[model samples]
Target: MDLKPLLNKLENYHTEKPNRVFTMYLNTDPADPDQQGGEWRLQLKNGLNNFETYLQEDGDSDEKRNYWAVKEKVQHYINENERNLKKSVIIIATADEDIWFAETLQMPVKTEFFWEEQPQLRQLKELQKSFPKTGIILTQKDQVKYIDAELGTVKDTALYELDLDTEDWRQHQGPHRADSNLGSGGAKTSKKDELAERFEANRARWYKSIAPELDQIAKKHHWERIYLVGPSDEVNDLEQHMNKKVEGKINKNLLDHEETKVLNEVV
Candidate 1:
């Protein structure tokens, strides 16, 4: 979801109880055949248990009591919200009983528990470095794909494929320019140029159709960082047609079309 706002809010939070922040990095991709999603609970349990050892070693008696007072609260939160987590989940609990949650596309491999005088955000800072609030649009002549990536997770938000005739591209071609007065080969050159323009026009039509949808998705999801990944020419055309809201979020355009490769670059 939208984490930038939550992060901003957490930055200002004040708490009297030992500020205990529970950061759990989980792999929630159930579709992956090799992943065992059922182990997340046990991982979280072990993580908190390890944190208790760290706390006992590092803190005085008063600080230790304050930290453990809210152990059950954090566990309750995990139980209630476990199903909503995506690839990565960050939970923050303070002595003031304020609980905050952020779900991201990026999942980290470890669980970290921290208690300090104030909110601990080191994990979030590191995550933001690798996973910015970004949306990716992957385009092809026959199909268009919209993916929203933030934190550490990647989601396929939308996909569109051309449903018209297989030879519709042929319609963009026309008879070679036949003007004879310019030069012997001017006709061929002019015809090729005209055909190129027609081809671009067709591509533009396809790009325009998805531009608004991308705009809606970005705004609805509060995606402030946008990446356009596809052929250079088509990506350029698509950006030109996007609404100002989406246009302002355009951070980069990549010269690639394969979704897996694009994910490697963005992720």
Candidate 2:
């Protein structure tokens, strides 16, 4: 599809209202499988009403409650703005290696494949490209220090530990954990349920931690559209979850890196 038009649209969207909020999500943890997909990284930003409300509901200490609140708010937003928000675009970024592998394998592949091909070799290359100033390849144990020095304090970013130990993660994937209800069969009702619970917990934690910042951004920019960029599956799930819960105040558009570049051609 034509990307220049999209980029121009984005530029126009931002220029028309300089105060509009733009937010991006980045997976900074190198150890995480999700973060290793790209070299530099990508982010999505848009405007939405009631973003602050979504942030407030995400603070529940109870993981289930937090998940439900966040989902509900998104659904409410979608329901309220069925027409204008439905067309919002989601942007994603994938590295050259990922695209090559997917085309080569003729199947969807993860970045781990490239890393496994030549762990040390690829690691060195990536590290060099990631921080050209660093002359040597640092060990995994030294990653935190290297990142802190190269990227500055990690605290400023949306980076944190995954709470695998939580019950939410143990039961269902991140998107559906809150809606789970224990059945008589127990044992998670099924393996699918268990995976869903885990995903929900992981995602909930990430969202909760970042919601406050998002709220501030929304308020600052007075956003009316939201773009979500990430792994296709994750972005789809997030959109579904939000639409089911938030109502009609937000619109979601999903797009991959190449598609995004095309969409943002104006920039």
RMSD of each: 11.1, 26.1
Q: Write the per-residue lDDT of candidate 2 for residues 83-165, one digit (tens) a residue.
A: 43211212111122111110011112122211111111232233323422110101110010001111111111121222334
**Model 2, TM vs. native:** 0.19
Q: lDDT (CA) for every model shown?
A: 0.59, 0.27
What TM-score would every model get versus the actual structure?
0.56, 0.19
- Where model 1 places Cα greater than 4 Å from the true spot, the runs are 18-89, 94-97, 102-112, 162-201, 243-261
lDDT of 1 by residue, 8-92 (tens): 8878865553445444555554454434656666766777777688778886676566557666666776678766755555666
**Native-referenced Cα lDDT, model 1:** 0.59
TM-score of candidate 1 to 2 decimals: 0.56
